[model samples]
Target: MMNNAKHYNLSLDKRLADELKSIGFIRAEQDLSMWCGKERSYFSSMRCRGYGLHIGSLTLMAARIADRMNTTADVRERARLRMALNIVNAVVQEKCRLREQELLTA
Candidate 1:
């Protein structure tokens, strides 16, 4: 007989981190270092109660970067950036359940 053992899944926080990282959320080494240099409580808050906050911050950062890249580009690039920003906004606002003001300040 084949053994059927139950497998435990990761907690929601870890899952969120994995998903965000998998979705092209790359940052500069300096930015990553600065972010990492924060107090452990910051990561703990993100890991525990700030999943939405982190998602908001990531999406906003992506949008900001896209805007900078699109400044001297063509319409096609702007459209692409718009779409990405919109999707990020929607995900952070709806899927991640972030309040508008909280997301804005994130």
Candidate 2:
């Protein structure tokens, strides 16, 4: 029973990965026809299709680096380090909550 369940789960995970690969990111097909204009293509003023994604990635990268610097190095003031740690903890807690909800729904 355990072996069969494990195999089924592995196959399910593989199928999901394949599906995601084929579909690509959800924002890859972002439409600007709603508030901007009636167009399926990206805005001419925008740099790329993943600017929003890139912004999120950059924010996370900076937070992780700053947290590490604050903890490992003794450069930041006590108040600043405390605020950074609080932000990190909040993000982690939110992620955990989201995962729990996902698992429950699944």
Candidate 3:
């Protein structure tokens, strides 16, 4: 079960990274951390702990990304941003579901 959870998190991380790269928003860890309104070590700590970002952070990040997408003039970049937004939204939904399940079990 632990291994499965770790694998799932790693997979999710890869998907998020790939989507961000596609949208050219992941030039550096500092840039991503700044966009998420977090310290530079935040992501590194999350990665080391094998967990994803907090739901609220993800939500804010998605909103910011969507705002950029809305103002983007390049068609290709807009499409890429849209795809990244979808990925972020999906992750946020999944995290919410997991949190709900935890609450119910508690």
Q: How many clashing pairs does model 3 include?
A: 0
List RMSD in Å for every model shown. 10.4, 15.9, 2.6
User: Evaluated with TM-score, which candidate comes out highest?
Assistant: 3
TM per prediction = 0.36, 0.32, 0.76
Which residue pairs does candidate 1 place in steric collision? Answer: none
Evaluated against the true structure, the overall lDDT of model 3 is: 0.75
Report the error of model 2 at residue 19, Å.
34
* Predicted candidate 1 versus true structure: per-residue lDDT over 10-83, tens digit per residue: 13334333443444442322332133344435545554543323554555555674665568477765665565
lDDT of 3 by residue, 1-106 (tens): 5566556655666667666776786876556566677997777688888877777888888999899999999999888778878888998887787667666766
The residue-by-residue lDDT of candidate 2 on 17-50, one tens digit each, is 2332344311222321111222444332232422
Task: List lDDT for all candidates, in order.
Answer: 0.43, 0.37, 0.75
How should the candidates be ordered by lDDT, best one leading? 3, 1, 2
Looking at model 3, the pairs that clash are none
Candidate 1 residues lying further than 4 Å off, grouped into runs, are 1-53, 62-66, 95-106
